[model samples]
Target: MTEAVASDGNHGSGPLEYGERRLLHLQAARKLLTEGEPIRAVARHLVAAGGTLEPWAVAALREAAAEAVALSAEPEAREFLHTARQGTDSPAVAAELTDLDWWIRPAAAVGALTELARTDGLPSPATAVLVRRLAWHGRIEEASELLAARPDPGIDGAVTDAWLSRLYPGAFGARTGAPALDEVAATHPWLRADADPGAVLQGLALHRGALEPLQMSLLALDGAGTLDTEAGWFADLLAAARRSSSRVAEALLIAARARVELRRGELRTAEESAETALCLLTPASWGVLIGMPLATVLESLTEQGRHAEVPDRLRATLPQAISRTPYGLIYLRARGQHFLATGRSRAALGEFLAAGEIQRSWGADHPGLSPWMLDAARAHLALGEPAAARELAGRQLRGPGGDRPRIRAGALRILAGTVGPGRRPESLREAITLAERSGDRLELARCLAELGRAFTEAGQPEYAYAPLQRAWRIATDSGAGLLLAELAAGGLGGPPVDPAEARGLAQLSDAERRVAELAAQGYKNREIARRLFLTASTVEQHLTRIYRKLGVRRRSALAAIPGLVPAADVPRPGRPRPLCARPGMV
Candidate 1:
């Protein structure tokens, strides 16, 4: 019998020690797998020892090894399958093999698993895996057929049914005799430790009540990957919240809208929505949820080149993120974006990879939720690994998870970045079309800018004008000032910075300009606020607006522009300028 690991959430007897020990063993196992040890032998050894270990430890090994199969090479995948199949003639081992096959050849696994199920009745979990794989492969008919064969699939089987219902609505509901809907009700009768979004959606479809939609809306937003394709779903949720008169639901919907708008590149709209949400949901409440629409607010600010203006409240919320979950992954991803925006790609890469590892460990390595693959690919390109970047993007594109229109758009965008100029325009055009159709305004603007650049580089200035003009209009209307400036930097058709120097300077209010100048003169926020006779929060707000108008990220960027701050007033290194330095002010 396996030794049960005592988990009291304490030092040596709990989950902490168990996790540490598992990590040590995983490291050893990885090393062994790296060496010439046969997988069957390794499996035999681990299984024998598993009798003396906690169930979690054994399960950890299984999950990690299974992950290696998808993330590793063909030889490694085969090795993992070999180990899983070792010394097992039972239906359990057969089911394990079927799941392992999904990592390699999903389509092939479908037929084989179906045959196995027909020959000998399979367990519910195994059946669920088969159905999920089939749905992923777009084999809805076959999956439905298999589901129909099992009269009462139990709770585990309902998971498969729920996925099928959501993924293929045409085959469910009024069209398919409500089979999927029936299964949904069977599995989720109450709240449990695990949240199933599909089950929640089914409740909405059945007109269960406001509470289900409210709860489901939170989970949906929390798990919303890259694509804003769920705009329709959000719309439905908002309508339901309004009907139910749920203030909390309405606030969450506003927050979710802000997130979608941010993805679309509508900076001004996203900020407005996020502000509304923040007002409805207090900052304290935001901290508890770890998603107060703050991320979108910060992202919008950063993308508009107002990085320095990102709310202190937003930055303070990072520590509240719960790792090893979708919520944490998204937070980590946003933080990574902040790093990337500020030109810290190395740190960005770490966060992105951490998010990716968590997603992979959960077996939810889809592009819709995390899109860590695209982020990491971009980092690799920045790190000057074109081959690696292209390879990684290509892998994601070929996977079923990449089938979502938004994921495909993102993957193509990365591919465009990795490819040569000759191939960029075509890839970018496709990406732009997808982004536009998917309603991701920012991605569309970026792709348009890229395509215009590609055309200009190809010595077709006339061909570039149309795309550039459209991009400029979108960026201007969307408050995507950073994108507008980037177009100018790329030598597209945006207003020349040199010519607009005086106008840029005039755009800031008198107080705003003063704060900008003081900031540019090496005074910190406290010093500047003191000198201006304004609260620090007010000063920060002024700075954000000033950054937006002037299209600058930091005081340095503001100082770099001529006619904004006097050259002589520019802060130099070494000694304190003391422009606003009071006696006690350091």
Candidate 2:
């Protein structure tokens, strides 16, 4: 018979030694098992032994497996379940094992689980997996119904419900109340102590629109000033994810880091991190959550001027349910930017407007989340509809996100384009100041470029030189090839011109000269018409006459001539003087 250890200190103890106390605890656990106590009563003691299963009873092993599953200790759970299975073919043990396996390798278990749900119905342990699967497949209503059928949905079910609530706030009839991160950690001591804390942290960060708590949590976890730097925090989180037993949790944490990197303008790192996260799970497994990483990758690629690679990246099969989430808005905006870069202004405008409609419907029309109005305004400007552009920019300026420096700067930049040359510098200077405050280098470059163009259009060559040079350096450093191209097309960054190109300046009328300068600077007839407030046909006629006078046939030949210099610098009598040639001359 196994020795029954004393619970009371009846063994005349002065003070028990460490070995004696451990032996006593082990014996007491065995005594409880022999006395027909429930396996759960002694399961913790047995698990604490932590070795080969030969010394443990089958019942104790099964209970240990269940406890490990609850704690999300996948490897320990698998080992205990395997040992228990060899001794007995208990269906409850098998179900627990299946659920454990389903968390990491859903593809292998989804078919069996689906059929089980259809027929005899899932055991409580398996229900959460099926619900998640249904939601992943875009059967959200069905998932909600199945979850509602279960009265006590357990810890896993509650976590899934919380994620769904955040991902699609109003998709179901009402919001499901989820426990806060602290509450969850307090209630489930096992999760707090043994399982990865990142799972809880990711759930809290999802769709919540705040990062202070996340940053604070990381600091607390790593001690003061240890993970305070962005790189350090990101690495710490990534290390935690790697050590986690759940692949889903790891992917979610990595994706979250990718988004943060994207916002910080670390494009290469964001793209790599997002790609790594996507590779951890299959597309169907990601469901609507795939949008987080996929959007980051798409936006990074698009911004880098690698437009040719975008179509293939976009060919992934996404769940239809993604369209209802904030992730979808990100993807839509990124695609619109791509369209604009590729000269599909009308298509880009349609995408931007569609995103705006969705935002309005969802009542999430905050410009900080997605400045679709500014995007639409940019599309309008590209389409040569400055009035429409101005209207949209003005509306954004007067709306919710207008107070944000970055959003305000974007609106001002667009507004400057639609206004007269006399007012353009003021709007653009304010835009430049706001862009600098926002710390977005790309935005600053855009504003500076516009200011330089305003100075150029006003025939203030001396004033244009400084802003254009500053913009050139910023654009080159930011890898903004599109902005660089725009600056180049505006005749801001080019070699010094030969004086001989000025010979035809005296032969053209003022209107014809304006058209000729714009043409030489690479503006199409429609674009020139928009800038000069003329019809396209009139601009085309002026271009034809200018080309004849300059002895040029194609627009390329026009570009070959040196860009417009100040009329005062031209050795011709018919040219007009610069508007802002010197200080106090405006």
Candidate 3:
């Protein structure tokens, strides 16, 4: 019987006791194989009864792992053999798991296979399965080396797969698309004889926020979706990037930022841009560089009230960032805010407290303390602990190093919201002034909106309207469509039927009518989009037509239409609306 030394991990029947080495060997071999670990490692690590590794142990690992690996059904696990192998012993297994899928996060799987490559023997199907699984998760570097010893990240999957198969017939590893578009961009300059470069400039003119001509051209090319087939040509360009070792990372990062802006209505661009950045940059580098724009997407989704999808990806992006940079508690706290924005108030609070723990872990003078403290206070406040939040806000504002301008305004804004009417109007006004002066448009927008809510709660609807309107304009002009849509639903200051009616049938489609009816009932475009799953812009375009057809210029005109809730009673943030109350409740 093989002597298994004490193992730390549970393989099903508790931690394998060193005394029960035979059972331990069986458990370890089965578990390791099931998880895509190579048989050789399982063999090498196994200890015999006399505490010696043996050939039988190695054979046992191989036989067990092969059996289990063959039985798996997950695309990552089931196709493990075929996904990584160009030629396989089992044709049946090869027939299962090949296709382009958004499900796999390629890099993660690649990192795993890189460790499995140092096996003590010739590559086995088990090892190949491990490698393919790594590539499936976008770990191109490891998969490239293990699979064919080189990866052309710029090319489409078919081209790279074919190239790898030719070079290393038996060991052809990752069968996924090479996703490093920045390197592709650097290698392949955006010049085409048939495509007019000048027309690129013309395309940018329609977008108000876009200013960079080069970026505009890139976005236009992507927007047109005409260049995807040309992905193969990018292979040569990526090879050049490897040879020159150029830093196109910044460009790729910007591409992601620009994609977030340009793709406005799609979540895939966020992943696309980040994947591109990940291919070129280390985890920490891309995490720090990509965090804000990613945060913006997270924030936008949260404001849109699409909480279901916001937390996971955004939260996953944080650990790398917090670990690598001395990002003073602010970014970490901002991360928590990202959670809250997604409607996970409790999680947001916990994240803030965690940041404070990190601050203590890194020591107080670390520049991140300010951000951590501010975030913690904000989180506590958001969780409805007004007194605790108020205390933290006061301390954060007056404490050592003092408050950063934007943070101070944020703290003031929270204080105003929780401090009740008589004591808060001044704080709300002060917060608005501070936010305006700092030019933190993100916080500024929130403060302005919250100010409106503070007044609304205080029985001052007229005062509330100005700030709400100001926030609404800021949201709209800045392409903060989520915030703009939220404000537009606030049915304030009028009776149903006081607003205008439709005149011409020409402007409204049946879909647009349904959309407008829902929109008029105080649903933001996000809610409408969710109910419809069409892009928010599609919903917006229909509404644009609705205004024209109904002869109602803005949401205000539509709100006055009969049947939806009265305008004044509509809930905005801080107002909370009335719980399950009829739409007309004050």
Q: Which candidate number has the best TM-score?
A: 2
Residue pairs with colliding backbones in model 2 are none
Give the Cα lDDT of each candidate: 0.59, 0.65, 0.47
TM-score, one value per model: 0.49, 0.63, 0.40
User: Order of all candidates by lDDT, from best down to worst?
Assistant: 2, 1, 3
Stretches > 4 Å off in candidate 3: 1-245, 248-297, 311-324, 327-331, 364-370, 400-403, 477-586
Off by over 4 Å in 2: 1-73, 81-99, 106-109, 112-133, 151-162, 173-231, 493-586
Error of 1 at 542 (Å): 44
RMSD of each: 21.2, 16.5, 21.3
Residue 70 error, candidate 1, Å: 46
Clashes of 2: 0
lDDT of 1 by residue, 1-586 (tens): 1123222322455544555555544444445555746544344335433322333334434554554443333344344445445534446557666655543333345567656656456766677666665554445556677677754665556545554443333343222333454445555543333545544543453221233344444556444443242557656756665443124456656776677777777676777777667665334333223443666666776777666665454456332324533445556677777778777889888988887777666555635546888888888887888887888788888875676667778788888877666788888888888887777787787888788777778786666766776787787777665676677668643432343555677888888888888887778999988887899999999989988888778767876664555423111122211132222111
Identify the leading candidate in terms of lDDT. 2
Candidate 1 vs 2: which has more lDDT: 2
Better of 2 and 3 by TM-score: 2
